[model samples]
Target: MLRKVLECRRCGYRTVCGRDDLVARLRIVGQLRRDKDPDESIVEALLAEYTPLMTCPGCKEVGLKANDADDEWDDDGDWQAAVLCEICRQPIDPERLEFLPETKRCTECQHKSETGTLPDEDPEFCSRCGALVELRVSRGSGITRYKRFCTGGCRGV
Candidate 1:
C-alpha cells in the first residue's frame, strides 16, 4: 500500500496524505472517523474547486496550472481561442482558419461534399450553432455551386 505524506515547503509542520489514504482507511474501518478532534466529531469535507489565475508563469510570480495558461492576460502571454468549423462540429485551429475567407467550406466538409455529393442549390444553416450557411451557385455551361457560412453566428438572437 502506498502511504501519502504532505510536507509544507514554508512551515516545518508535516501532514499525512489526506485524500487517497484517508478514503482507503475509511473503506477498511466499518465506522467513519472524525477529521477533527476525537470529542469534536466534526468532518472536514474537501472537493474539487475552480481557481482562476491572472498571471503568466514564465514571468509572473504566482504559479499556474495547465489550463490556467488560457486565463493569463493577453499582454502577458498567448491567448488560447476556440475555433470550430461552422459546418462540422469538429475543432479547427484558429491559425489555419485565419486566412480562410468567411465564404469557404471547412476542409472536412469541403472534402466530404466534393467526394460524396454536391451540396443542394439552396443555402444551408449550421445545425449546431444555427449560423446561416450560404451556398453560391455559378451558372456555367453547367451548374457550379459554392458554399459559405453566415458572418454572424446562427444562434445569434
Candidate 2:
C-alpha cells in the first residue's frame, strides 16, 4: 500500500510512516494531553508538539546551517513529501496533493484533457521585467480560459 513520507528537499532525509504508525502516535498524544482547547484539533496539537522536534538527520550529519533563530535545526523549508505529476513530471501543488494525493496529472494537464484543449507552446515573457511568464488556467460558467503572468511578481508593474 502507498504511504505518505516526509522527505527533506536539500539533504534527502526521509521519515517513512504508515497508517498504523500514525494511529499509534495519535493514541500516544491522546494519552499525554487530557485538556486540549476546544477549537484546537488533536492533529494540530500533535503537529505543534512534533514539528519543533523534527530535524533532518542528514542535515545534522552534514553540518548544514540552521535557518531558524532558535536552536532547532532545519533548512529554509519544512520537510514534506514531494509529489510529482505523472504526465508533466513537475512538482504538484501542495494544496492539490493535500486534497487528492492519488492525482497523477497537474491542474493544467487535467483541465486540458477534460476540455480537449492544448496549452500554448510558445514561451511568454513579462513586459516589465522580461522574465518568463507562467500560465494560470481558470474555469467559470462552463468556459476555460488561460491567463499569463510573470513569475517574478512583475504583473503589477
Candidate 3:
C-alpha cells in the first residue's frame, strides 16, 4: 500500500510512519552517524534535529514543533507545540506567539522582560522606582486554591 509520506524538504528526510519513523531514524543516526552516546535521550535528539527543520528556514535559533492533541496528530498536521528560542532557551506555546523575535516592542526587550520569561505578559516596569512588577505565588500539598498578589514595592500602595 502506498502511504502518504511526510517529507522534510530542508533536510531531505521522509517519513511514512509518522513520529515513530522520525524517532527511530533519529535515534539510529544520532548513535551511528553522530556518534552520540546510547545513554542520551532519543526524544531529545529528535527534537534537536527537528528544530533545524524547514519550519523556520535558515533560522535555527527559533523553532517550533506540533504537540499532539489528545495524544495524536490533528487532521491537518496542525497542533500546538512548545516553541523554543534556541538562543535564549525561552519556550512558549506555538499557537500563541504573542512576541516573535526581532520586534521593537517584543517582550525580549531588556527594558521590559528579562531573558527566560514565558511569553505571556508584557511585563510592567514601575516608572516611579524603575522596578518591574512581578507576582509570585507558592502552592503546596494537594488541591490548593488560587491566590494573587502584586510583587516588589507595589504592595498596599
Best by TM-score: 2
Q: Name the runs in model 1 displaced over 4 angstroms.
A: 1-76, 101-105, 116-157
Better of 1 and 2 by TM-score: 2
lDDT score for candidate 3 against the true structure: 0.40
| Model 2's TM-score against the true structure | 0.27
What is the RMSD, in Å, between candidate 1 and the native fold over all Cα?
21.8
Tens-digit lDDT track of model 3 for 12-102: 4433333433343443333223333433355455555653442332333333342322323335565433343323434434433654533
lDDT of each: 0.38, 0.51, 0.40
Tens digits of per-residue lDDT for model 2 on 1-157? 2233545557776554333333333333232232232222444455445533444446743222212122222253664445555455456798998899888778988888788785553455566775667877865766789877788786732
Which of the two, 1 or 3, has more lDDT? 3
As a whole number from 0 to 100, the lDDT of residue 127 in candidate 1 is 53
Residue 38's lDDT in candidate 2: 28
* Ten-residue region with minimum lDDT total, candidate 1: 43-52
Please identify model 3 stretches exceeding 4 Å from their true place. Answer: 1-71, 76-78, 93-96, 99-157
Models, CA RMSD each: 21.8, 19.0, 17.9
lDDT of 1 by residue, 1-157 (tens): 2223323233333323233333422322222222323221111222111111212213433222222112133454453333444455344656567776453356767777778765553444455554456645645666666545554555432
Global CA lDDT computed for model 1: 0.38
